[model samples]
Target: MAKGTKSTWSLRRKLILAAIAVVVVLGLALGLGLGLTIGRNGGSDNGNDNGNAPTPTGSPLPSPTGKLPWTPRVNDTWQIILQNNIELSDDATSVTPNVSVFDVDMFDTPKETIDTLHRLGKRVLCYWSGGSYEPGRPDSDQFQKDDMGKELDGWPGEKWLKLSSDGVRTIMKSRVELSAQKGCDAVDVDNVDGYQNDNGINLTEQDSIDFLSYLSNLTVPLNMSLGLKNAGDIIPSVLPIVHFSVNEQCVAEGECQTFHAFIDAGKPVFHIEYPDNAGSKLKEDIVQNFCGDTGDASGSGGFSTVLKKMDLDGWVEYCDQSVETTALNSTDQGS
Candidate 1:
């Protein structure tokens, strides 16, 4: 009976041991399964940056800690071609006339072209209309019907936009975001001067000031610069935040003095004068008529002026009589 009791006790101990061993094995399997499941669900709680985050694509644009935005200097030379995309060979080492900055249509220009320009040590100013709606733009439909006003004079299929509309502001913000994404050094926001036109929206100078302030807030954090395009009346209000002024025909309209506030504030005035005789190389007299820094060109002493045709094609002539025609892929839209 004692021997039988000893054998029974040994068998009970084995069974207990086997049960404990099986529990241990099952607990380990459950722990491993939970670990893998958490990992698969992006719930890893390791509390460490394991470098497994999803990588982002596209060019590295400005962040809160990225490099400061490019600031253009007074009297900096520049070229603007809005009619089409500027063509550049991938292997080419230089651009024509080799100016310091090129303001091209943001949508029309390819990222490769902007990259090429950067490789050539040139800054790019992406152009987009902020206060006007144009058909055929990718974001054109995004604007509400009530956000549009009368058609812009001389610009077919383009209409003035209400500067106060939230939808309009949203679209403009996206355009600015696009400029930053494209690695553009600055953005030339055009048609902010709708207050000066017979816009159906009755936009006032105060509206322009508020709109520019809004744009400044977006651009400053993105490390991109903002430019006021032909909104001279509100210069004093917005000049502190605006980095530059893209004044069109200021020399012709006796308004260079007004836009020269940018120059006086240590900012650039990228002045353009559209001459009727700009299709070909301008004569010395015609050059003097616009670049003389007197009469209509008064207060343009420090302006970085360019002579172009009314259509703003690739043909450009500088004050010093130098001319260049940027090669284009020949698309029919402005960015």
Candidate 2:
């Protein structure tokens, strides 16, 4: 009777072990099938894309190769000081008003300042002339005389460049490379509206479109963002490639509607309005005129607006009626 019991127990143990092995094999097969399905779909149901998802129609442009560039979102707070480089000590831990991004002159801004801003958790947008020739830039002499066009009306020593010129594009490529080297998160390409201005080179809207594409080619590989500066007419053409819009006086000119497309596209509009008394204390009406949501300021609801001096100095007034001046080194530079 004891021997019979032992035989029965051994058979039962074998049966249980075989059942466990079958369950383990089934789990492995199910996991493998799920992994292959997720791989084919480019992402899992958890909403994380593995860089293989299909590019959606009308989406913000992605880089051709390498990692994607920084994309500034709608209404992201910012401060732009193009007149001079910011003043930040190496050991400092904070900046005034504590904005998310700072736009400074690319050539005037030292690498050390950019590094410090990064340490303080702020991104830097290096400002440079993409469609114009400025006299004192380090690459000023590299611009071919044939590429130089008519002088800008109010900005002295700066002339529009032929957007189609190969020489101009080469110089711009170098500037983009320099921006990458300086730890700049993005580049603000100014004067792209040369097509609207009296550009002597007969720059058409198509020229601006092509030029931005060329710039995108250079900026994308470096993992740097690019911004459109007041070229609202070509927004439809270049919007996919650019990450933001550095609009000047859209509120004052009643053209804020044209730039709202960036906001709609999930990109920021770094709007700047130079009120009459912006250099000093601003009056209530002036603030309302630029920052109010009604009338001229309609469709500008998500703009990152800043009331700055015409000179674009350090003093900045936000839509909240709060004013702050960024500290700057005495060394000044032209835009």
Candidate 3:
């Protein structure tokens, strides 16, 4: 994990977590973001997060709830963000970027916007910070001082949450329920990899795995899909429970190989990589490696990869060098 350039200061922030695929976390340190498979009773009781649920005792086995909503498939193209609300195209038969999915801010987006994406044949994944506390989210007041620890470096107003806390688990369960109510096909629970960082909560790898199991229970009953965001080490344990995985910088950090479990298991690894140098255009070699790391032990043949800037706005460039800019509303432009 040698250091990278300045535009990738975000990359450097992640490299600080060396070999842990900490790249997606730079945005976790901020936002750009980004589902579940599940059972009915893995965490707390249904729709009953009083911010006082118990720690997940091993994941309840995956018991199909008769019907499941759209679980993102392997090789599904997608985009992600949390800093702003996504604005879809007005055309009813067509969608901007025309990707199979759009992963965006959960609370910030209106249900009408999600409904619009649905009309255009897209599965929407709502993003929520599941492992950390942000000062501005609608549920900010619910977090107690003892429930959280140190702020995420380089990202203001964000702190690593105590994953083992019964109260914190309840808040996360509430969020999963919200995603279902808002019509999200899946929920992307970010920052669950806090155990891999300097998260002051002293989180452990098992803590993350257990928390993921807990999240799965909440969505499975609703029939909403779910994804594990970049806690690669726990993939083996949670793979049966989650629908897919949302990853950051596995290519750049050379850990793309580790997520083969997701691909081999017939699930998607929604992967992203910021360039070694930001601001500079995507160099030919960089694009070649990210999209074409094919047919090898390290080659990620089935990953749905996207090249994005650290901010994770609508602008996206694919492996083929084609680019699409989704429209951003005035409110999303920091206006």
Best by lDDT: 2
Kindly report which residue pairs in candidate 3 clash with one another: 35-187, 35-226, 35-227, 36-225, 36-226
lDDT for 266 in candidate 2 is: 68
Alpha-carbon lDDT of model 2: 0.82
lDDT of 3 at 126: 93
**Clashes within 3 Å, all models in order:** 0, 0, 5
Rate residue 268 of model 2 by lDDT: 81
| 1 against 3, candidate with superior lDDT | 1
TM-score of 3: 0.77
lDDT by residue for model 1 (237-290), tens: 888777788988887788888987777667788988888768678889889878
RMSD of each: 15.0, 10.0, 22.3
In TM-score terms, candidate 2 sits at 0.81
Residue 161 CA error for candidate 3 (Å)?
Answer: 0.9
| Over 4 Å off, model 2 | 1-66, 331-335
Order the candidates by TM-score, highest first: 2, 1, 3
Q: What's the ranking of the predictions by lDDT, best on top?
A: 2, 1, 3
True-structure Cα RMSD, model 1 = 15.0
lDDT of 2 by residue, 270-330 (tens): 9999877676667878888888778999878888999988888788888888888888886
Which candidate wins on TM-score?
A: 2
